[model samples]
Target: MRDFNRYRHKGAFCLMKYAAEDGSEVEWIWNSRDGVTPFCVSNRTGDKMLQHVDWHLDRRIFDYQPMPCERIFVDLSPDRARQRAERTIEHYWNRDDCAHIRQLFGTKEKAIEGLLAESRVGEAPDLVEFGSLEPGAYRR
Candidate 1:
């Protein structure tokens, strides 16, 4: 197994390759802001498997644990991840009857911070969450 510590940095970009038991190549890209996306290249002719795979950062182990599989290679880089994170926009929403959007943030951490600040001032409720969207999406 590759050392996951080197890849678990904030805003890091990690590209991991895997070989499935059925002789297929899988590529998984992990971005802190964008989350994980998996691409599968089938070796058998006319057999294609493309689907969304759920993965999460395991805080206890301080590593990302995907569905049980062996990883072939891991490439960790921060430059492109940081650049993309800067361009992405996030929405901070208060969990209430209407789920009102409070404000826009550049990152999830910023949205959490904003929510915490508002909660401290009694301006926002305790149930707050954030979601990412494209730039200028809120204007439409």
Candidate 2:
């Protein structure tokens, strides 16, 4: 067999469909998130397996780990992912579709900060209203 012990693959945009605290299914499209690390060697057996590992491209290698989610899967392309992210943000702002999620980000400023931190050049801006970012404005 060809050496697949230390292989890496390009990442892509994907939707993370998960259950809320109320057991409601929510689909959130993640844009520009870290890609999956497939085909890893087992530390104990040295056996190669397609164990999925999540990468934190923006952080150090030590930050990488297996995804905690048990049901995340791909949903669409990058363009669609951007559109879905926009819609998700709109729901959060207008109807508080996932209010509990804010607790994970702390203050509103911190939430905005988190959004800005992940933004890439020429990419879609966050749907959350911020400085000069009018409500419902999804594009930069």
The TM-score leader among the candidates is: 2
lDDT of 1 by residue, 1-140 (tens): 64445543432333333345444544453332222323443332336653323334322233443333322112222332333333432322434542333335544667555544433231111111112322321110
In model 1, which runs have C-alpha deviations exceeding 4 angstroms? 1-49, 52-74, 90-140
Give the CA lDDT, 0 to 100, for residue 62 in model 1: 30
Each prediction's TM-score against the native?
A: 0.19, 0.23
Q: After superposition, how far is residue 76 of candidate 2 from its true place, in Å?
A: 7.3
lDDT of 2 by residue, 34-98 (tens): 34422322222233322323333322222122233322222233444445545555557434656
lDDT comparing candidate 2 with the true structure: 0.35
lDDT to native, each model: 0.33, 0.35
Score candidate 1 by TM-score against the native. Answer: 0.19
Residue runs of model 2 more than 4 Å from their true location after superposition: 1-5, 9-34, 37-76, 96-140
